[model samples]
Target: MNATNAPDTVFETQRPRLFALAYRLLGSRSEAEDVVQDAWLRWHQTDRAAVRDPEAWLVTATTRLGIDRLRAVRSERIAYPGPWLPEPLTVDESPGPEHRSELAEQVSIAFLAVLERLGPEERAAFLLKEAFDYDYDQIAELLDRTEANCRQMVHRARERLQSGRPRFEVEPARHRELLERFMHAAQRGDRGAITGLLDANARLVSDGGGKARAVIRPLLGGERIARLYWAVARRNGYSDWRMGTLNGEPAVLGYTDGVLTSATVAVSDGEHILELLTLRNPDKLPIPH
Candidate 1:
């Protein structure tokens, strides 16, 4: 390696992990990308030689920046016109630590939505320890908190997130099968078929980001969601349904006249779909014009 280029090389090595941390913390793909870029800038400006541990330095900088970004966006999220779902991210064949381990579940829409309940500092602490596998001491150092405090944060976060997160993991094949069934049922406007596939307490959350048409609030109950799907099929109609993976789980994208309309993914138990998260905001969809 070129001696002068060592710093850049080192930062590049840690970039993927840094990005994974930011994305989980912020939820929005664009916002997470922005935070990572900002972290790079700070790394470039700092005195590299003086930093004894580059990884530790970078992690601290990234966590602080992510916490600040979360605090900054709190009000904007509250005033959001409708429900604010995480921007859909298409996990591809990218070489990164995020693709390995159980990281996918940590980044899922359902999990991230549950994380929204945490305070910025608390969220950072929990994610550092839980998602990234940082030791309690490392997390405490990264967040400038006591070890006991970091433990408390993770414990509190887990408790708060428990009710919203799935208790059991569904097999990948089963998850894909359920998504396929939902797509076919929705397209056919078969209310009974859709209802039968849903759990007793299923809910549907739609996010349009106030840029397009979407529900003002989440629809609760299996029957109500099934009815809404039926109504949507009857009135607007759907074409070119594409099934794929988003955030490491099965998702289906609906398009009309070759223009993307909505992207939906489900949170399922082994037996039933607990919730459906649909992103209709064109700006947030992962597509190129």
Candidate 2:
């Protein structure tokens, strides 16, 4: 078949799946869209007749483009204002018949945040194995590593994830309820209520990026965090803080003088909040005009 005759049909059929893969890898939808567009360009440049597995070819093209862009953008990420959270996913339009339930827990904000802790190669290895369900051989080929090494990387990444012990199985509705209650307590300066909602070992990590005044160190323990919240509420209570959905999960966004100042997303385990992530680095906020 001539390249012009049928590749368009093939591209259209495969584009959505490629997008889902790219988004999960890149953590930024806009960047994923760009990478996919670049992949199409490469696809068009190649001799369609020479290609054996179009899907595999597309995946390789997309992954390489994403990795390249990630390397190029690392400097900008480091300089990002306040706490740099992944771009909030406004909608979950993952392509195809895979239900949200079928998607792995790694797609959650908390999970992605943990993925950010790994080195680039480790992150790539883990995503290819866990999220895409690719075998070690395929992951090695995609990442240009030996199969044994790739397996080791995946094992190490999995160990880190396990150590975090995140509860990705929590229902969104129940999680939202807990977050709302916590936000209300914080807003009202109810130290007792807030303390009750936090785990004894809960920690609050604020990303103020030196622009906004935030607790630099991770605030540990339920009692300490509760007291911190009380002090903050007493001082900044006048600010308009609201509980809302962020990245399809429960979050808190605060505004001062009609300008967005900071936001927080908490990871909970049934009974209490385990990790409280505050993004106050002004550079990190995707301010809407």
Candidate 3:
């Protein structure tokens, strides 16, 4: 292996895993890319011969970078006008340690919501252990903490996560069907039908970023959320919805007369949706094809 080519080859090989680690930590593609780039710069400058564990070195670099970036952003988010949702990442499949279907589930809008609530260290510790399957010892070394401390952090993250996460998983086909039912009722403003399709504890969170007409806080309960849906359809006359995939899950790419205005994803527990996420922030929404 030549001097220059070796580093590029090594960085490229681990890029996806590094990016995944950053993305899950920061929850922003742009920021994650920046973090990965920073890791590359450091890797390129480091003494490669002395680094016995390239992946370990890269993982540590990427994760610590993520935690730093996350801490900086957490302050910015405090000033954000309303509740902030992670930028919806579209992934057909993530090439990482987790199983494809399971990974997809973990990246769902709802799951990310739970992760967003966690502190930076807690998030790092949890994702390393749960999603990436890093052993506690490895995680402790990565985070510069003791193994027992990392284990405790992961346990607390799990407890906090479980309280807000969905209880069951739905297959892709069933997920699509649920989105269809949601679209049908939402378009027609059928409160009763919407109620039947929503869990008793269903919650709706809209992110307009203060640039669009959206609720600034979470709307809780099935009946109340159904009413809000009715109000939206009535005002916008959006009786039609286009089916699409967001983050590899069935989602509603809502349109007003063929003009894309909103994108929505739901997290369901087999029987009904447990949480719904609507993104109306144009800047936050994905670019059109």
Best by TM-score: 1
Model 1, range 1-59, lDDT digits (tens) per residue? 99789988989999999998899899988988899899999998998889999998988
Candidate 1: Cα lDDT at 66 = 92
The candidate maximizing lDDT is 1
Off by over 4 Å in 2: 1-9, 75-82, 91-104, 167-174, 208-217, 238-243, 253-263, 280-289
lDDT of 2 by residue, 200-279 (tens): 99988787777788886677899999999899889867557776545545567787887777777788886688888887
What's the distance in Å from true for residue 112, model 3? 1.0
Candidate number with the higher lDDT (2 or 3): 3
lDDT of the structure predicted as candidate 3: 0.82
Residue range with the least summed lDDT across 10 consecutive positions in model 2? 91-100
Clash counts for the predictions, in order: 0, 4, 0
In candidate 1, how many clashes are counted? 0
TM-score for each prediction? 0.92, 0.79, 0.90
Better of 1 and 2 by TM-score: 1
- Descending-lDDT candidate ranking: 1, 3, 2
Cα RMSD (Å) per model? 3.2, 4.7, 3.5
* Colliding residue pairs in candidate 1: none
Q: Which stretches of candidate 1 lie over 4 Å from their true place?
A: 91-103
Pairs that collide, model 2? 81-281, 81-283, 81-284, 82-281
